[model samples]
Target chain A: MSQPRNREQTEQRILAAVGEVLAREGFTGIGVNAIAKQAGVDKVLIYRYFGGLPALLAVWGRSGQFWPRVEDLIAEQPDVLTLPPPERLTRFFSHFIDALRRRPLTLEVLAAELVARNELTAVLEEERERWGQAVATLLGGDDAALWQDHIGATTVLIAGVQYLLLRARKIRRFGAYDLHSDASWDALKASIAAYAQATLVRPEPAGHARQDKP
Target chain B: MSQPRNREQTEQRILAAVGEVLAREGFTGIGVNAIAKQAGVDKVLIYRYFGGLPALLAVWGRSGQFWPRVEDLIAEQPDVLTLPPPERLTRFFSHFIDALRRRPLTLEVLAAELVARNELTAVLEEERERWGQAVATLLGGDDAALWQDHIGATTVLIAGVQYLLLRARKIRRFGAYDLHSDASWDALKASIAAYAQATLVRPEPAGHARQDKP
Candidate 1:
């Protein structure tokens, strides 16, 4: 027998194998045997280390591959919560769409969470709550009644974007937007930004100080 | 062998079985043998009659159960196309949401179409195209550039509503919207109507005659 891998190495190998399966077989190919074979580890290791497939998926989601990673981003920016509401929202959704575009696996995981009522559904809920808190902070401390409506509408828009992009993976043009073209992508992002501005831009009274609370 | 039923009866039985499976086991439970067993018919009959599972789903989708049957609705109200675009869109989406709320199976089927690249996806595309054309007529014929944006945005909204309702079947609340309560439901519908009106409403020249044609 060959030398055994350390715990960190084994975890990394398993996670990398999950990405490999996602790359080769798309969403439908995710399975325990497939992941183990790809990782060159025994299938029992997944149960021992990660508990099960759902936990494994949840761990993979929090890994560097998937995002909104809002906490980490905020840790970097530190004042992202203090920008003007509209600008803050624009940055938030732009980062969101960027992360979504960069990580197809995240979308697949989200799609699975949407469909299946499993352990990962709770993970999705917790992650969404975190994102909601971030947006609420940007929307003026959650006391504004408008934030509720904003969250509802923005959630719909986000879900819609996720569905459209997921479908765009197969068919390019759905309506006015072309998913494959850069111009169309820019137009889509611009439309989203405009939506953010339209929905979240609240006029301040003249000479009102900008709220930059830490 | 017993006396054979006519083609219509067999088809109806198969279709009814599909709904039974959908109602009892949800979207993922649908398969050839299960449907055939539920219908009390040979599995070969599925291929012989409906061509296959996807074709069966497509046929079931176009059946009386699903919503936004615009052709049928138009036949009932010959002048619906002549209404103000905003009012027409509000009514259209209200009806759309009502249909969605009434028919959970339709949402399940739609969710399946969203996730998997199957025959149902093509069916969904064709159905969406038909619905888009109907909406285009309401938005003032096919030439108006605004209709494209309207369609794209409305598509996103419709997809979002579908996703939300499907999730609401399990989790009651995600963000600020409560999907189960009547007050929340009214608020949700109001928001959708507002969205529809916001997206479709446009100023026209005074004395502009509303377009109406077969």
Candidate 2:
């Protein structure tokens, strides 16, 4: 029992070191030697326990703390599903942004994902897909159909939130919004709610559907 | 005269080589040694001619090739301003997406911008700001006011296009749309047009303006 407990503690330390290195130096600093140094352990232990960097990162990604879980999205509003679709979207984005803003490590990984396609990012993408699927499950049935119908618009709004939040990690402002300020985020959230209300409640008229000229 | 002409040719070769290296290996491969090797020139020439990597990237960024110019946005639509606001937006996004899609190097830089904030991305950001200012000037007066009124929504739509386009460089699908497929892009563009039409034409009612809970 003592031996197994010791091994688990060492593994936990190694994982914690990955977050520290990632926060301080971004993905470029992630390596067995660096993590082992940060964890205050022998480099061979990392290989023996986690196999290698790829496997280590896979384990790290699987750790629920890497990205926001579905619980985070609905933490404040326990009866989130009881709200109207527009209100649900508003709360969802508000919670989503708040959750992401709190996690600097996740922001760093998201920024890195835009440029690099290494094992770390690959693992993170899988985790993001899982998170997305879980959210879909939570919004199952009628609400899911509504969002799916306007999938393109829904994707754009969510991606916009992601891009701006990721941009906030590096720069202060994007367009009119100061990413660091709560006021700007408030306005952004309102706009998203308004967009959701407009899109979900009323479908675009057929005659107004404009097609690009070939 | 011959000396100056030879120097000019060498400089062009060096700049071209930056693009080559950037496309092949992303921003991480950008350095004096690699660029010099690719250009088949002495490393000293990179410093003497362009004043080193940062200056070289700066000049390269300003070379009218790093990103799409305002001209690219309105190339096919000289009478774009005469159209309605929604039509102008539709045309702008269509042209903008097409221009970006045509320039693989620009997409590479955009992706790199999200992760790393090196000299290359810094120069590119300045160029992007200049291009944005130029677009703003073109859309000055009434149209500008209209866009400003719904700036948050407008930013989200544009950022969505950018994020999705950048994602397409690495992954094939994002949500319901296949990033590589034209049909998917058509759907995205249509959604943007619909969104622009909706937000611009109607202001949210006062009673419906939902403020997030404190």
Candidate 3:
């Protein structure tokens, strides 16, 4: 592989190795040494690729590596906001969900993000607010309530999924990854769309939904 | 105050102080030294009352220290499960939301927790999971799917509220404390109840609901 390709390959190998370790050994279970050892690379190389273990672990948690593929999947679906007036909200929500199903890591990140009670929640809050603002603009409501409903629905769906995963007695018992499945992914998308449609169509406080933005 | 009463009073005072710090300073902002100085209690008392800074902070977060009286207001509400069977879900959801509104800390804690990104989230996930499971049990369908939906919805609502709290100019924004209004609270309660009713009364397939314990 060329040097650029070589770098990509190395980073990919490391992340994959880290995932495997995370699978085998929970978040607290894996360490720099173990991840490096698993990838058959030196610890220094791991540092070179990722600032350190916590940083690497956080990246994995954020699902950054998974977004490109998710974005592609989202692009494959019709944009929910692009439809003619009436259909815009319906189509936008439907396709937004379709995109969510294409990436399991998105769900994983969301599950962790919701229950975050301490210091780490800042990033989660910031990410959702950013998305909420975008969604609010699309929904054509005063940014406040629109973002609230949009972000709230998304957070609960994630928690609900995580709850199910635990009820299945996988992660709660073993701290293991749920073997990803198409049925679950589809369900997540459908539920999200259903919730969003319910949200957008619902009557808002008078004058609130009539924003100048969208 | 009697010794026990005095200690309890002291503990409450300290917890309140910590809450004030967290509200203003964020998690990393407060220190044992600062809390001691701000609280006007001997520094050693913090360690004595709550083992360490982290433990004390957890108490502050969990007890609704900053916003005070939300849980009390919620506790004052009639238990939702006691209502007519069909109305129980609505009542329960409404009551829970009333509690959330009364305690805006529900949103603040959630936002702060996402950023804290430490053992804090682990603690929150477990705590919220238990609360969700309890809500599921109260609803008609306490099965895995219902559990998923109830928990998921709750998580998302909290997230949405947090989204509103975050100053999102690119999207939408809501004044932090001011967003809580009786009418808005009523709407929130209704929305939550409606969503939960839809979920608990007619849960979809496991895969579709994306039910999993996080």
Candidate 4:
């Protein structure tokens, strides 16, 4: 019993450490040594449990940390099929953007994963699939209205923060995108929600699949 | 008279050389020797005409090979006061994007310029007055909208291709973001236009300013 608890504690510590390092230094700054040190876990145990930065991040990247906090706003799982398109779509998108705001660390890791271009790509791809499912589910729980374009607009809207960060790296203009400010967060939530509402309500036919092979 | 025309030809030749080198190699890859060789201009004259890459790029970066195409779309000398609210805004944005599509080289240079940071940022800062005026004209043709969120969004949207390229750099799983593909370009143009329309129309009553800077 004690062993299980100890193992859980160790894993949590490691994850917390990884989160801190990623939030602070981002992907370029994160390493096995940094994670272990921050977690206060033995470096070897980190290897044993998480494999490496890639594996550790795979779990982090693929998990529910990226999902919005819908439970707080909605009483229960939305019967997406039956709900009026506007409220259902708006609320769901609001929840989605809210979720990203709730987990800025997830945003950080996702961007880092995006740029890492390494073994993490598979994990990121899986996360992308999960995100699509999440968005599709929000679209109608299978009754998606204009799902394809809604998804494209959603991708761009949600991607705003990550995109800003990339600009920050190139220009080294920190604070250009302050993800933490409450007003800033509200504005982000508003911008995406506005975009999503505009996008999901319309009746655009499904166009061709993206020419992008990947 | 022939000598003056020859001098004009010499200046044009050197500027053309800058654009070519930037297209073939990224910002990191450009230097003095290559520019002279490519331009078929004497190495010494490069210094004489433009001083160096910094000066040459400073000039070229402003109204050179790429932007003129982009600028042609918007009425450069518009009577700002006469233009209507969203029409001026969306038209300016659409035209700017159209211009970006007209010449592939601008996106390439802008992409490299954005990522390269230091020197380019200084150049961008120098051009801020001109950029601001042009962007402000697009926002509403009025001075009020210039200070708000719309300009930032527009600038970022203008910078969207760079964001796409940077993300592509990470995945390494696909081809380039073709600015010319009708579907892709149309979608991109629509999104930006839609965003501009939404941002500028029925904008908040004049005096509101975001309290927090992000």
User: Residue A161, candidate 4: how far off, in angstroms?
Assistant: 5.2
lDDT per residue, candidate 2, B39-150, as tens digits?
8888899999888888998788777565777877887878777776667777888888888889888888877777777676676666666776676666542556556656
Candidate 2 lDDT by residue in tens digits, A112-192: 777767777777676677776777666543566666656667788778888888878766767667889999999998878
Residue-level lDDT tens digits of model 3 in B6-79: 78888887877876776566554678887876677777899988999778766765665333232343355446
lDDT for each of the candidates?
0.68, 0.76, 0.50, 0.55
TM per prediction: 0.78, 0.87, 0.47, 0.54
Cα lDDT for residue A179, model 1? 74
Q: Give the TM-score, chain B only, in order for the candidates.
A: 0.72, 0.83, 0.55, 0.60
RMSD of each: 6.2, 6.0, 11.2, 10.9
Specify the poorest-scoring 10-residue window by lDDT in model 3 chain A.
Answer: A170-179
* lDDT tens digits, residue span A33-150, model 1: 9999999999899999999888997787566436566665445557776665556666665666666788777767666665567655666677777776765665555336546556
Q: Which rank order by lDDT, best down to worst?
A: 2, 1, 4, 3
Task: Judge candidate 1 against the unseen true structure and give its global Cα lDDT, from 0 to 1.
Answer: 0.68
Q: Which structure among the candidates has the greatest TM-score?
A: 2
True contacts kept of 1: 0.31
Worst 10 residues of 4 chain B by lDDT: B171-180
Summarize candidate 1's per-residue lDDT along B5-93 as a digit string, tens digits: 68889889999998899888877788999998898888888999999998997787666446456655445456766776656666666
Cα error, residue A173 of model 4, in Å, equals: 9.2
List DockQ for all candidates. Answer: 0.28, 0.38, 0.07, 0.11
Off by over 4 Å in 4: A1-17, A39-83, A140-155, A161-181, A184-214, B1-133, B142-162, B172-182, B191-214
